[model samples]
Target: MTRVVELVEHAPAVGVALPDAVGRALAAGDIVDAVPDPYVPGHWSLRAGSKVGAVAVATPGNDEPITVRVTPKVPITRLFFLLGYNLDPKGGWRDGEVDVTGHRDLLPALAHAVERQVDRALRQGLLQGYQRREETSLVVRGRIREADQIRRRFGATLPVEVEYDEFTTDIAENRLLRAAVERLLRLPGVPHDVRRRLLHQRARLVDVAVIVRGHPLPVWQSSRLNSRYQHALHLARVVLENASVEHAPGALRVDGFLFDMNKLFEDFVTVALREACRSFGHSARLQDPHHLDEASAIRMKPDLVLYGPSSAPCAVVDAKYKAEKREGFPDADLYQMLAYCTALGLREGHLVYAKGNAPHAAHRVRHAGIVIHQHALDLDQEPSGLLSEVDRVAAQLVNTPRV
Candidate 1:
């Protein structure tokens, strides 16, 4: 029997495990550690600093292995929405068929979303009818292959290489889609229905398209005739470029497949805060890089910087993922933000963290005459509520002095 352990980001799950199979699997996955309890004797719990949204399968030597999945404490669906927009603003969850409701595993959910997007695109058309230069033998027109005319198939057919506009299922777009679906099919724990859909979609694609493994697909532009595939093409590119496989003796570990929650959080906050500040005559600049030293070798990159309509700095914000224990012991984030403020000649700055204990904190430098306001954006709230928090940050910047 296999056991399933689910954990939230920055949270731990504690349980007792059998020594032989389960214990080894936990060790392999880095999901659990041995804990000695006076009452419970031998116990195991989650690792100290596992990444959020990372799912690992722990395989014991012989028996069925346990699966451990970690989800963000903030509503997982909201994070996906953020990721969808960040990846492509015009393409997002609400407009597409990406349904994550009641999803047990984020990886499989992403795969299903990708499959659905490709499936939807195919419905518009089989993505064929593209003219490609072909080299083959024919009885009639096309450039004849004189070498093949006498050497091979002399009297049967003409060997020719010609460019013809024809309707065939073999094309690069279909091949790339086919490759991505095939890759997803190999992943373990995909939903049964999703697997069936993947299989069905793969069959619809022409089989002869060459599978160029480990090569990035070229980006193709869409015209008025094939404009329907622009969104689907972007989704397919993201999935194919990011998804990969890992194999072992008796197990397959699907690694390097996850949405980076930290980046997602930063992008969401910056975009929202920027939009909010627009009403107040301030535009937010993201990742504003400046030379910190006279030599121009040292550079400081602030996550976000607000500028007035006149093009002057208003406030600087640094988004930190953990902003707490997980960020390590040193107070590095504060030091970095201070550098940003000093470089930009601003007296006030802001630091935003994902909500944790002590939701709001303020710090004032004694001699430097600078202020750092720290606020936590509560992720557990609804999207509207979360944006309202950003609204507060934007409002604070409006009143900030230009000094």
Candidate 2:
């Protein structure tokens, strides 16, 4: 038997056996847990983590796919607006793209919309085609590989292995786009016919290394024409890396499909603050590495490190998912921030968190120069308003001298 499970971000899918075949794949970090259901006594619920993807489970009775689509819990408009500010920054990346508003499943919807944009971009012709180095064996080619010629002289015209760069449509960015699209096609939530069309579209581009997998796309590829390409690249990144896919003999699963809004909120703020600091006549370091121990072996990584005009540490700011009231760990953040302040010899540090009933709070250490400020970002507000809050945070971090 197959099961179709649907869950909200960080929600649980209760009472699903999920078959024996899928057990291993789920353990391989697909971000799910089997726990006793609180609502149902003496029964288990398949719990979900923060990820979103299609889980394919193979059933003995049929060839149908078992899927679990993880949807966002927050308002779609809010999330979309946040993404727009972070992705486009100045309204360039989203120009000419389909509106993501009202999509039932945001992940697949994004993948599909990206596919359309890719198709449209390709129809106009690939932008910035350049020579790529490829290794191959050929009898008559631009260059000959003497090492391969001596080893694999199979008495064939393809014996002369040659490595050379060729100008072709296949590029790293295209490969990444294809890889993401291909992964999305496995999603059961995506319409089957649309999957077929996506497969066809992906086949047009030659496969290449997904080198841009864990890293950002190259800076040189930024241009007016590459706008769509860049957006697809980011979208593909969300599909390929953000969403988790799992499979086994009788089970293929995409169960782990959740996005951590906490992290998203933090990253958006930090990146914006970094840029905003530049405008405020200061330079900022993000995730700056520092040695926390005398041995200089233990490393301490802070979310954002603000530096003064004199190249000294001005302030440090950390982002938290929730406020101190709900999270109940402001003290831990205080300890960490104090270390940052002491290392830089600054008097204060800042912590940003999502808005809660007790959003704004402050703390001061008795008989010490250290102080920590806790501010809340009203995520429920409009994106522009949220950004304005970030601007205020920036001003608070840098207004004092030596900061």
Candidate 3:
């Protein structure tokens, strides 16, 4: 006998129950959809949709009761498929036959899945493109591990080992996605510069981190990073826009490019921020442009704004990419970051400069109860080596009492 199960979201603890067939379909990562039918008695047809996250399966008829914990305010679509019986050619009904079961909600599910997939693809493409720009990058200084098992009659023994390699690839590909979109916009016969300018604007919209004491580094491609950026952009846009639409191929491509660019910027910032946090035993979030307060009115935006573990302001960072470091100090950069610290009620801020510039001494100044720091990012070392310097700097920040 086929069982009828009702899927519902529970309060306090949010989760969803999955049937055996549905679980299997999700695990297999099928492309689900609903289509109009003429020959069939039903008005609609049900099928698979695009894949996003990984899936796990449960044994059939076990009924152990499955539940999935979900993020609050995040909408998830659940699809139902028909299983159990069908009719035979000999005029007898067959038992335990599974086929497509129609659901009114399937259309929206398909749209959501496609949207996510497209976003993911675009982000991945961008990261891959950036990594391709440079090769032989330095690996971060951290232990890496993999697992192995030795089987015996009594029991299986699991063992693991660690290695330090020169390759540590974790940069996201959103930047590459932006590049692709710009390329498409610049394609011959497309007269609209608006699209091209929009693409450029999107490319410039990125979170940045400035490493103070690191060697020059190489760049590499990462598909995983690209996908993540794409998803983040999609979520951000969707939340900001508050709606969905049919899957447009051109729109998908454009979105993919934007997402990739966003991801690249995010990754770069994350690494630098992580290094700072690790050194100081603190953490930070990319500041939202919408949350700027009156104190920071003069300094509109900063590359990075760090926070203490208690959510207290730590430091403000601004990143610059220049082939040559300025003689003495960059006054404009210093003033801008100092303004951010003053506005955010922070005590210290930093100006991080890119590599290939003439090295200058670190500068410190106190203004309006805040200290502004100017340091250069050494791109001459590997990524890992550069991160080590970041960690040291963060540690110093934490050890030193706030002045």
Candidate 4:
């Protein structure tokens, strides 16, 4: 699909009316009932009668413009906007506008554009959370002694002179080391060999050092060979300084150094899904504390559950960040998801893996007459390509006939 970008304005009160303008401009089929945001007090909700896709209303900022960009399931000529303006305090009025500016077909282009904006905003929000955690204060103490003398003494003697200087008290340093590592790992365009080497060597060392330091570590490197990785790590470190983990309740310990790979994968998937949903003119709501039942009396909580297009359950995607994909689907995974599907009454589920593997053919399995389709998402792909791939899969689900 060609990329789309859109910008529009609507009154907060009349924002709900913009959907109709979108439906008309895009010619999105039928008005399946609209669903409002249970969280937001006054938000818009509109569903196409044909169940093509969904749209979400973003929270407004201080006197900021209220706008939504719609990317359609199908390509269309012009992007339409149902703008709402506050005509009076009691209520507001909405009107539709078409942008025919500069050889740009507003509809689909605007859709992609709006999605990118929303995705950027959402990512910023997530990064902000990470930033907050990173901004934690680290108790650091420094003493001004002759650097050459200290180095010479340390170099010559096993036991170096140690002195506690009252003048240089403990200073709380803010460093974002972990966030830098994560950003480097997720950065696109870095060569695979380079990434692999960093992951195996530098990344592992940094992870260990972070544990040892009990605070974000400083990166001291002049080599151009791994500059990209180094730069990313630097940024991640900055983010880590503000992250919640930096201010963890207890004194940081080495044992707590164990990084939660699963949680990292989950966060990555959430970002991916948020971007994907935005591209489809829909917003995704994460269903937490997802309940699942199994015959073995063991309950499993999948990483994330997403609701798209009104309240309709769209997809269940699980994230697996392993060193490599196991040969042939793991039996345990299948069994576990089988139970999850049955419990949730879902016909299909997805398993997203971080490392790139030969794309697995979609599988169809039947349990109690419920056919569950399983697929794998390759995280190794370029960010834009990966998001586009997600869009394709979502469109297939929306258009394909269900068994």
Q: Which candidate should be chosen as best, given lDDT against the real structure?
A: 1
Overall lDDT per candidate, in order of appearance: 0.66, 0.65, 0.36, 0.37
Predicted candidate 4, C-alpha RMSD: 23.4
Please state the error at residue 355 of candidate 4 in Å: 6.3
Ranking of all predicted structures according to lDDT, beginning with the best and ending with the worst = 1, 2, 4, 3
| lDDT per residue (tens digit) for residues 299-355 in model 2 | 888899888778878888888765443366556767887787776677888888767
Over 4 Å off, model 1 = 1-5, 13-45, 48-66, 95-97, 128-176, 207-211, 221-227, 234-256, 278-283
Instruction: Compose the digit string of candidate 3's lDDT tens values, residues 2-58.
Output: 232222111221123443344433333222232444454433333322211111223
- TM-score winner: 2
lDDT by residue (1-403, candidate 1, tens digit) is: 5455665655655665544444454455444453444465455655423344333344536356445556666565766666666665444444235777667556676777777788778886686655555456454444555665556665655445344456666766677677778777765557789899888888877564757775657556667755655556666665665453243324444242444566777887787777788898788789988877878899888888898877988789888766745347676667777787788888888888887733577788788888888888887776668778889988997776755
Per-residue error at 173 for model 2, in Å? 2.1
Alpha-carbon RMSD to native, per candidate: 5.3, 4.5, 25.2, 23.4
Error of 4 at 185 (Å): 19
Off by over 4 Å in 3: 1-270, 275-281, 288-299, 323-330, 358-360, 366-370, 397-403
State the number of backbone clashes in model 2. 12
TM-score of each: 0.75, 0.80, 0.33, 0.35
